[model samples]
Target: MMMFRPIFASLFGATLFVATVLPAIAQETLPSWSDGAAKTRILDFVKATTTEGGEGFVAPQDRIAVFDNDGTLWPEQPYYVQLGFILDRVKTLAPQHPEWKTKEPFKSILAGDLKGIARGGEKGIVDLVMSTHAGMTSDQFAKIVTDWFATAKHPKTGKPFDEMGYLPMRELLDYLRDNGFKTYIVSGGGVEFMRPITEKAYGIPPEQVVGSTILTEYAIVGDVPVLRRLPKIDFVDDGPGKPSGINKFIGRKPIFVAGNSDGDAEMLRWVTAAKGPGFAMIVHHTDAEREYAYDRESAFGKLDRALNEAERRNWLVVDMKADWKTIYASEH
Candidate 1:
């Protein structure tokens, strides 16, 4: 009788809690999102997955949503924020590495020549990252990233880089989290670089971030054991790597995935291809007024293959110009 009484009370309490919470979920959701198919689709998915005894209902622990950091959550146009960090780091470290003045990528970087950096391609960028991001301990690198974000401003918006996360997307993150979904940033940007500001910017913690990373070596600095950053590529969490990183870190396939470029194709493909009811959305940079709009030919955040795939798969494509009433948070 005692065991039965306790179980009945627990069940009654859960029912009463759901009775009060479900209506709130249905009513107040994504206020920043404009009225459109994109908004409707997102709400529908959340409802289906969150409602009790629904066919698409997902357990709260299983309700994982992954998002690409660049372009999707924030602007990655003109140049990637991490690349800018590397350039700044180069200038700061130039006195230590005197030969950088004569080096190819370093020479051009010091001269503030974006054209030369572009010409250096993936290899040049990797070189720059290795030179600037490496050689420091992991803790030191994290401090450098946090310090950089304190002052770095977006060239176009003139706002601090940390202040440039998309308003609608930030709202979506909060909405999903409020609806029992765990939001994670699965980006091609550096893991260390993104970790410092992700918590403040997106409400996602550093532990939930997965991104490209460099190898680090364990060392003893006096009495402290430290992981010193090495100038070697450990992982590139872009394209197919996104899914791999997601699986590695989150240990579960996300039911919802948001991305802004072809680099995120495989991640979306992995998510939507799963057996259950899944949702995938691509952020099409259509608003030239609020943000930069280049897809196929853009050096950063190229949205070609993923754009075509989204259309063919009937996935929601968010038109920044029409769908989002405001772009940046400051706009609101």
Candidate 2:
């Protein structure tokens, strides 16, 4: 009877072990986000929307998440990539327009006078882009962007432009996709400029990207159909333009939206205003040690208005210094 009791106790202990281990195994198999409330909230939202019997269960088609490209997904420091392209363009075109050596914005750019360039502001940026990006066919523009991205490296990091992407953001993107979310890049950079490299860098295909665009015209160039880039601005995917771009390009409002600055305020507002369940987040760059950090005073990714709005709305504002264990994957 004592031997039988010992065997029974051993079997009971084994059963308890299995019961405890199986659930932990199951949970471990699930995609684990960074350790924090933000990760938990994101996982919870995704689970609620994807689970079969959950109240927020959404069809695969409706699982749309839109993310801002610059600053949100990657580092947009020293200025946006489009600005880099424009600066390079200025350098390239400088020889032809030697007068640019004496001009205000062009001269500032040629001389690498960043302070003078800063003084030019939004109007300066617009003029530079219009001058450089226009006159070429859309195909030419695409090829130009592809060539530039292949060669250009970030100034401070000395890494390829694509490699500067935020590591945690990439993980989040993959996790969302695994859970059936279709992620889209909504950016203020030119659509053509981003289309060539976004898929390789961010796991978002060209079809899922929306950005600033110039008017184009279809014409036959030597019996080949071509789209010529016109100087006319079709759209600028910043501020209010963001929501409009999403509506025009994606048609359906996104269930999840992530952005970094006041430029993305309207997009966040638009997503949160949808009739049903929605989530919005803003990445607050606060870690100067790991990566570049600036908020309200910075020209790029300025966060004042967005911070206030995020607080008022109870939106998640991820602090890079606090939330992230690391910044870029390359650094790790």
Candidate 3:
């Protein structure tokens, strides 16, 4: 009991609560979610999986759910939150590295040239991340990221970066945990970067997060042992890498997975293709009034291929405009 107890997000949690709990609790499960097929499907999946004797019933230990962070949990419009961090970090460290004044991506970043940065593609973004995110001890890097979140405000929302997580999704995390599901974040963003704010912003702890990571090694400094952050990337938990990372780090095949962009296509595919009952959903960006809406052609959070694949795979395509009652945490 000691070993399995901790893995369960909510012991005595799952379908029983939904069946026996008050109407208010049921309504509160996903308060920000509008009444629609999307909502119905999610609730139904939980019910089925938690109903013991039912064909869809899954054991408590098998109830694993994974989510993509940026676009799914919060807005990744204009630019990714991590990319925003990278840009700001470059500027912050620019005074220390005077050579960055004339560097390609660094120079473009300092000039506020999003177009130039885009021109460099994924390679350029990776380079920028390595430059800004590495060289310090792991603990030092985490502290820097935590400090950045404390003061960094979104250009569009004017809210702190930590304040932008989707309230509906936050509710969903609680709902799943209430239903005995172990929730984990498998995002493309840096693991260390996401770990700082995840537990407070969302309910997930640092141990449950799996994401892209740079290399790190143990070293003694000033009579203290520490894991030093290295510039070389160790793994990228996105696109095709998502499934591989999950297999490598998480071990268990998740029964539920949610994502927002093409970067999440393979993850959705991987989860839904499994032998048992699996549920996959894509948070489609469709509300221009409350949030930015673009797919297929958008540079950031493009949802083209996965959007197309949803129908064939029986995946839930959540229409943000029509399905969500509110967009941000403050909206509710």
Candidate 4:
């Protein structure tokens, strides 16, 4: 989830979908958010930070906002959308790798033994990602991800994966941009995988997206220069890595951050704990009907430590069921 590069913007070759998805900038901000303290916090922070001569006033150049992609912007259960991609990919490539029938995670994945797959643990997950995600040129991999997005649907709603962005959050993004905040996505998802669809779905260009990455090298293949993806992780933009990745990519502390899960705990603390005018928000997935609800015990987006820390840090914990007048981008 973080440009990634101009390549993604060029490959996508489309303009922002905000005009159709959200109201004009001059209209009411976050209209899909129900009246509450959560909404008020966002409004108050934005107002205080943008106003001239105010104690919290932040220059437009300094007004940066970073957001986590999975649970924060969309649903993460029954599992992450990227995991769905991984599982499908493992199947698609299985016929070529017959030995996968005996491989630890692959065997379980093919047999639909999620518990067995989990038994393989983090190494198993990394192996799965590297096997399918690397070994191609960056351009080729991006196309593969984009093509998958063209057809991938959420298991629950049967809607296109990219189409499931939360409507209220989308409005919040547009609203922040309208007020001069440069928004970025700092997520654990692969940067290239997300770059293809983020601009169209969230009105955030590829260059503004940051996420986990694998190694890549410049090479000349068939007399043409290309960057080839390698089967080695370069960085992971989650948990403690989120803050470091932000510093390396953006070169400044953001005034606002949004996320859901303990994986984003460090980012939340890093932003809000800054000297002044910083706001951190957690999108509490509490709506079991409009959206699936689980917090402490959820495997996909566990939100325990961050939920407990929100009160002490004064971070806004958005109760999805209570605070969202609408859940999905399509709801608008």
Please give, for residues 1-332, the per-residue lDDT of candidate 1 as tens digits. 89899899989988987899877766766766788889999989999999999999999999999999999998887888887788889899999988988887888988988788878888988888888889999999889999999999988889997789998999999999999999999999999999999999999999999999999999999999999999999999999899999989889989999999999999999899999978999999988877977899997898899989998887889988888888877875
- Stretches off by above 4 angstroms in model 1 are 1-28
lDDT scores in order: 0.90, 0.87, 0.90, 0.92
Model 3 score (lDDT): 0.90
What lDDT score is found at residue 83 in candidate 3? 82
Q: Report the lDDT tens digits of candidate 2 across residue range 1-332.
A: 99899889989988988899777866551232357888777888888999997788988899999999889998888788778888898898888898888877898999889788878887876778788999889889989999999999988888887788788898888878988889999999889989999988988899999999999999998989989999888998999999999999999989999999999999998899888889999998888887878989988888889899998987888888877877777865
Candidate 4 local lDDT, residue 259? 96
lDDT of 4 by residue, 104-124 (tens): 899999999888878999999
Q: Whole-model lDDT, candidate 1?
A: 0.90
For all predicted structures, in order, the TM-scores are 0.91, 0.89, 0.91, 0.91
Q: Positional deviation of 67 in candidate 3, in angstroms?
A: 0.3
Q: Every model's Cα RMSD, please?
A: 9.1, 6.0, 9.4, 11.0
Instruction: State the lDDT of candidate 3 residue by residue for 1-332, as single tens digits.
Output: 77887557465575556567866665665888998899999999999999999999999999999999989998898788888888888988899989988877888989988888877777887788888888999889989999999999888989997689988898899999999999999999999999999998898999999999989999999999999999898998889999998998899999999999999999999899899999999999988878898999998888899999998888999998888898777764
Clashes of each: 0, 0, 1, 6
The alpha-carbon lDDT assigned to residue 309 of candidate 1 equals 95
For candidate 3, the per-residue lDDT at 112 reads 84
The candidate scoring highest on lDDT is: 4
TM-score of 3: 0.91
